[model samples]
Target: MALRFQNIKKKFGDLTVIRDISLDVGDDDFLVLLGPSGCGKSTLLRMIAGLEEVTSGEIHLNGRQVEHLPPSDRNMAFVFQSYALYPHMTVRRNITFPLIMREHKWWFHIPLVGYLAKRRIETKPDIRELVSITAETLGLTQVLDKHPRTLSGGQRQRVALGRAMVRQPAAFLMDEPLSNLDAKLRTAMRAEITRLHHRLGGTFVYVTHDQVEAMTMGTKIALLRGGDIQQFGTPREIYERPANTYVARFIGTPPMNLIEAQFQGDSLRIGDRLLPLPETAPRGDDRKVWLGIRPDAISLTTADAADALPVRVTLVEHAGAESLLAFDPGSLRVARDEDGQSDIMATQSGYSGIVAGDRVGLTLDIAQASYFDIDSGLRID
Candidate 1:
């Protein structure tokens, strides 16, 4: 089902948390709401689930207005960060609870009368079959009788997911569902969730503060900051061509380096060095500009070559298959280090022989660089 948010706004009296946010999530799209803390991504998700009220605007589910409907009436399953499973109930009971509530009348919920409810439920073959299939799909069949506390973190999360899956809702809303897992488990769950999305073919609206989760799992990402969306696009589009300096700084591991420079004719003046701009590079009348270069795009070498800018290596970070070299370019204010010194980064494959205090030459790929307006901080190219 297609999910649409039209000019959605949320306010907490004097504070406007979500400001005119609008997005269209296509059917079966894994739309990720990514942002830092206090960015209103969770609040937006809650509003869609009817857990939080929308101050203004509309929410449409499959072309039907649902902003005014209760969460139960919306036919959407919510998977929470806390899992929110019932500790007293077994995994089977927890997974089938939603189904029972929906199918059985209120009188069946009474303590003594619930015995008849159990018999009625066992008589219905579909509910039992669904619970068994969901348990097997989530690898929780062995733990179907186990309490949540007895299961591992990953197993508990699976039970939580199983609960949502049995509901067979039109869409799934997840709020940092894997935040409790360790790094390795998080990686495993990421793949599992992606596979589940494919198998179910259900629309998933996920919220997370982790860029790795957003980049790897999302078909489209809505990058939010201070309750406003900085940019909304595919992972590659936003990473390669960021809408503004904020996005350029936020999306990557080492982040893109932003060098303050002056545009002079066909060249950019960074201190005393003149870096020539490619013919295809964006041009603006403004003399001042922000030049963005990803770490992987800059090549560092010991030998000096034409068009190479000499730099003093400040630090070399070794991370498994890649190494990040932080350097001080002649006079360009690219990024700041702990010592308040300006630094730029170049990434190399595998381990590096380069060390701190080593002098190296950096060759920038002008064609791969991005230009932004200094004043507005908006991308120029």
Candidate 2:
């Protein structure tokens, strides 16, 4: 289903959690709402699920407004951070619970034999087949008769997902559902969810604070902050071309480094060394600006480089294939200990050449660096 929000607003008491935000999820699109903690991403997801009431605006599924509809009537499934599985219920019962509820009439409500005699649900057989198929697909067949307490965290999560999937709603809303699992498990599950989305071919709106997950999992990302969306675009667009300094810093793995710089006519200077700005680099009107560069963009070397600033290598962290070295460029003033004496020293030229106290020339990737206005904190490039 095509899901859309128009002028959406959500308020908790007098505090507004969402403010006239508008967004859309095309059919089968995996859209991620990503941001830091307390950014209202989860609240937005809950609002979509009808768990949180919308203060104002319309939520449309296939061009039909469902904003005011109750959670059960919305035809959308939500998988929460906590799996919220029933400890005593078997996986089969868990997956079939929604179907059973829908099939049970007010007149048929009873204890012992009522469940078995529930007007012989026409969809019961279909639901059972679906539950089995989905459980098998998610590798939960072996544990179908077991309770949630007997399963691992990942297994429990799958059960919760299975329950949601059994409903077969118009769309799916997930809020950091993989967070309870460990790192490796999260990685594996992330791939699984992506694959599942592809197979299910349904609208998926996921909320997460993990930027890497946001970058890798989502077809598009809507970045939020302070109850409002900062920017919305495809992953590549948001990563390669962030709208502002925050996004530019947020998207990268090591995160973009923003160091103070002074513009010297055509060249940019971190301290005394002039950097060769890329032809496409944005020009900053600020005599002083922040030079934003990704760590991967800059190459470190022992040989003196012409465009490089001298750096003092203090620490090196090797992670299997790649090594991350912490260096103090000549422009930065930092405490350095040499021959047992710890003192504050500023590399005058930001030049590099030192294993300890001396400096080594460190080249900044000026071509890839972006200039940001220091005052407004907006990217110039």
Candidate 3:
């Protein structure tokens, strides 16, 4: 049940939304299409499900080309963000709908006859047992007789999943399916879906703009920008060794700090402070580079600590298990923040006694730092 996209492209009139993209999703792999809005993650997912047409190139399922197939012929079940269950039908009816449609006949198209045929199909021994197993699997048996409107958001989402499960498709294509729930519910559902994937052991291609979801759930992530993939790798690979500045800034909480620096003979210069470079750092004299340091890699210490850079704390935020401190490294310019301000950030576990307006010493774990070419923004490995 692997999926392969070779030089795939999609366009709406003159505007191209998916460029010449090529990637492979292994059998039973949970591949997440991750990016910000308008990055074509959803469009790519739709292309896999045949809901949207590929403008060029090819899409293959298990080595068979399927880009030309219609939605029903693809054998992929789609779970949508809206939890698209029928309001007039009970949970059992909704879950059984796909099964009924698959065995439909010409006489089933008639108004009165269609209703009767569907009812008969729903009560068949095999259909009832299948629906019952799906309901119990999703913890939906208690709500089987209820309509969609009477169910909670989580329950309705389960019903949508149950509907998809009844088909036993080759792959599950989800498009932001958990986005409609509240924060707590979304967190619960994230775990639920992970467990479901493990139980079913089926291929899953999910699209989402949330980095947390991408990091926590995906076995592999394809990070896209505009219409092109910026980076594709496992969560640890992408986090520890980003391909470029865009990925460095997009993957972390508070993101990685990119500071403009000079690479001297044997040291890197940040503002007036000179620090020895890591053993693996690229050697260059008088070259400009972007120095990337994760927030967790910087430690706050007393002003007299060895190799510490003096900074003035500007803001301190207490976030449950950790404290985020934003500071000003005098005469040093930090890369532009998301809100257009320049500030160096650090994190300390548990509660922090340090407050704003305090001058402190910050020490960076030089070995953990990343270097990038200033002009190209690509990692300088």
The best candidate by lDDT is 3
Q: lDDT for every model? A: 0.87, 0.76, 0.90
TM-scores of the models, in the order given = 0.94, 0.86, 0.95
Task: Flag clash pairs in model 3.
Answer: none
Query: What is the alpha-carbon lDDT for the whole of candidate 3?
Result: 0.90
lDDT digits (tens) for residues 125-166 of candidate 3: 898888899999999999988989999999999999999999
| lDDT by residue (tens digit), candidate 2, 1-381 | 498989999888998888889988888899999998988999888888888888889899988898788887888998989989756567887777776665653434446323543333344677768888989878899999898889998888888888888888999899999998999999989988998898888899999999999988999899998888888999988877677777876787666666778776667777666765666876654388767767767665553667666666665545555555566544453222223322222222234333454445566657766666777877675
Report the Cα lDDT for residue 265, model 1.
82
Every model's Cα RMSD, please?
Answer: 2.2, 5.7, 1.8
RMSD of model 2, in Å? 5.7
lDDT of 2 at 378: 72
- Return the lDDT, model 1, position 66: 98
Clashing pairs in 1: none
Evaluated at residue 82, the lDDT of candidate 1 is 89
